[model samples]
Target chain A: MEGFIIALFVCMVLALISKYLSIPAIPFYILAGVILGKAGLGVVHSDEISRFFSEMGLLFLLFFMGLELKLERIIANPSKVLKGGFIGLTIDMGIGFIAAYLLGFSLMESFIVGAAFYITSTAIVITSLIENRKLMFKETETIIWVTIFEDIVLIVILALLSASDQNLLFFFAKIALALVFMYGISYYGKEFLVSILDRDDELPILFTFAAVLTTASFALFLGIPETLMVIALGAALATTDPDAFEQHARPFKDVFLVLFFVFFGITIDFSGGINWFIIAVICSLAIVSKLISGMIIGLTIHGSALSGLEIWSNTISRGEFSIALAVLYGSPVIATTIAALVIVTSIVGSFTAKYSTWLRRGIVSRSRKKALMHRPH
Target chain B: MTLRSLNLPGVGTKYEFETDKGDTVAIFFTKTGIIQMYTLQKGCKTPSAAEMSPVEARRLGNILTGAIIEADQESVEIAFSALADLRITIHTFFVTPAVVGKTIEELQIRAKTGTTVIAVCRHDRNIINPPPTFAFEKGDAALVIGESDQIKTFEREIMVN
Candidate 1:
């Protein structure tokens, strides 16, 4: 069908744009989605295909997250990552929860919004940090550690999202059972498989993907949450041969992620149902709350206000997870608004982070000037 | 052997490490230790890459070499903060008669300056974690990890008449 070809063309154009611009490619992908999907020309119309791929994208995203997750490192103590993540999560979710309620969303939708805003895009921040040679600095390190914690927190939210719609006990119990089984298989299976194959690279990936797919299919047949099953599979696989998956499966994740974003874009009706003002307000509030969240986390880590600001600046963008949440719980109004917010924050977040030093200095000088003007002789 | 090196002439060398899945990971490294990475997969001919620059090429190189593993944010902070006691610094001495002839043991850098010479990079040599018996040569640049005050102490010994 033309669906696959149309998807490829959109992704290609987005890729070209990303090549010239020094930003995360997600927002651009979204833009491509906007142009090609229902919001625009309506070129690709197969909802079933797009939906399936989007679901796959979500699995792949979490899978990649699992691969990069240095579980042992994080578990190794009551360290900065834990501390900052704890503080950031508190502020982000707490503020987001209040804000969502004030805006009149249901309890479920409020949780979704809070969870969505609670995360800063690790992909965007890490990219900029390395590009600008900011990693050597203490603040950048704080961001990295904080991101690890954020990932774990988001995983919890993802679990909640999957369990949100269901009769809690049923969904959660099955998910738990599935997770236990998956973990045992992944943890034990890794060593057994490695004996049969050494550093071959291809096998671990193929095996893991195959296993996850099988689990997903089985879950679907059994009426369990397939998304949660895949996520559990990914996290468990992380305990096994992470290097191989990171090397091989990551590329597939990226490809599918592009598909997911395009699908997300297509589903959004950028027309007229959503209130633009509410979107604008929430978007603005998201910016402030994220800054506050990052700052608290950063401050807790390094005990510096500037460090907190740097953290905020570093991770202001919302990407895959946020969009996934929006698609799930967000109404047409909310989804469209979120798309706009993601686009704005992604660009703004990068700029703020890149020129944080200058921005800080400018603020300091202006405040000094204000103090001088107010002083009595 | 799909891991071919491309000379980006103006930028520096780019190493494209193609995984067995036919996914290409290109790490573009510059002389000054800047590293940018890109990945291509899915038979998408257009190389729509993310400029993955979250760590130094030097640090990443060390990671690849197993010199560092999982030195995450907290651990790195602790290590750097500990540098108040002693830090890492590199200095190159352009072949002086006084400093060139002494062996590392004779130079006694650790004893005198509390500075351990982690590596000695000659123009044509890679002497990482050099032995104490490693003799000092003209134009030897040493990467030392020590306290600031101690680095000053060691610099004097290396810059002789």
Candidate 2:
């Protein structure tokens, strides 16, 4: 208990410092875990209890995301949502899976690797957009919708993939059932829950937390990934009222999230045979794969070469989501590789964002001048 | 022709005129501070009468006519007139250096004025009908509602220039 408390304190301190310093907090949290973990000072041990609770951090995080989602907005822009989601996921996952396969990973390992790579960190993307004051721009809105769609697709894919080995038809049937259940919960169950919540003037935070946990556990029982189930619950709530859920769950989310990072940091074995070559290969793959995928999606959608490049550059930054996926799957190599890639890509992405406007302006000006030159005057 | 010769919506006068393509105009009342404006262009569809209230159409029409007359060098055709009324209420007050940390209610009482605090603007977020217990922070834009004379005095007394 003492060690856990100490580790938590250290992780919080690191996270606070990193937040102010404009550094991504995930790496610091992971570092904190390593320092206190068995691999370092051994102040904290990697135990199943800690792991189980810490995993809830991801669930709450997704739930929080769902609260913000509005299905109407997606329905309004179906073409962009569907095309961008399908293309972006396919390119990122396909290339990543191929790379992992080439690196001698088993099919399952490659599949997990692909899944990890395919998901762009929503926190990182949204934060960057807000910071840049580009959140209101048309292109940014498009990107946001695409990212949201990708997240939804990921939740479904993760759930299905994590289900026990079954025939294709069985898997399809399970997916259909999950969708129907989600719809029912969203339409009917949500209103019932909200009314109950409204009547209870002194509703304890534990009740809400327990409800989410129980739902996730129930999902696991039904052969669904807990992460997917949690996210689905969140998405359903999002269809109703986000503000209430945000108000209720925010405090608990913050507490467990800190533990989640500490646990993640503790799992990193820095000194246990560092493979520099493998790290380098993974880092390179991360950059190339995302860049190619983003560029392809941008070009395909906008039909503008310049916009495609800009899109490619912007999508490169990876952070918490990538790390969380790695940790969830218990792949240390994947985690470390993703961590290194995030650092590299954030630097590159920041630089790209800084100059993308200028590049876009130049391209537009050149095109205009060329058009004028071609004029009959 | 005199200005009164033109049949304006408010003035109850009807005048026939032609407007050039891609011409924009704005009409507004100098007294009430209401303004309405739109563009007259080829291949542009006008909003339906049902979409706009009678008063709004009149205001919008006047503004459009005024804009067209102002840009008389361009040809324009004016038929039935309508206006787009943009009502802007000046919900303004000042943040005094002295009353920095006090709650809004306490400040309202201490200030000894009937200036109703309508809203508080903190950074990008706007809090409307903020609670009495809501403490005032430095650099907050407090939107007050009251009689014009009282508001002016309140602004002068409380708001820092």
Q: Pick the candidate with the highest lDDT.
A: 1
**Deviating ranges (above 4 Å) for candidate 2:** A68-72, A166-186, A189-192, A196-207, A270-272, A347-351, A358-377, B1-161
Regions more than 4 Å wrong, model 1: A164-171, A195-205, A361-377, B1-161
* lDDT, candidate 1, at A319: 81
Candidate 2 lDDT tens digits, B1-161: 12112211111122222344433332222111232232334453231112234566664455665422223121123333343443222345447777688887776642665567777888969999888898888877777665445555665666644
C-alpha lDDT of residue A186 in model 2: 66
Candidate 2 lDDT tens digits, A213-323: 887878767665667667667767666555566667888787787788777767776654556776677667777877676677777787766657666656766666666
**For candidate 2, what is the DockQ?**
0.04
Collision count for each candidate, in order: 5, 24
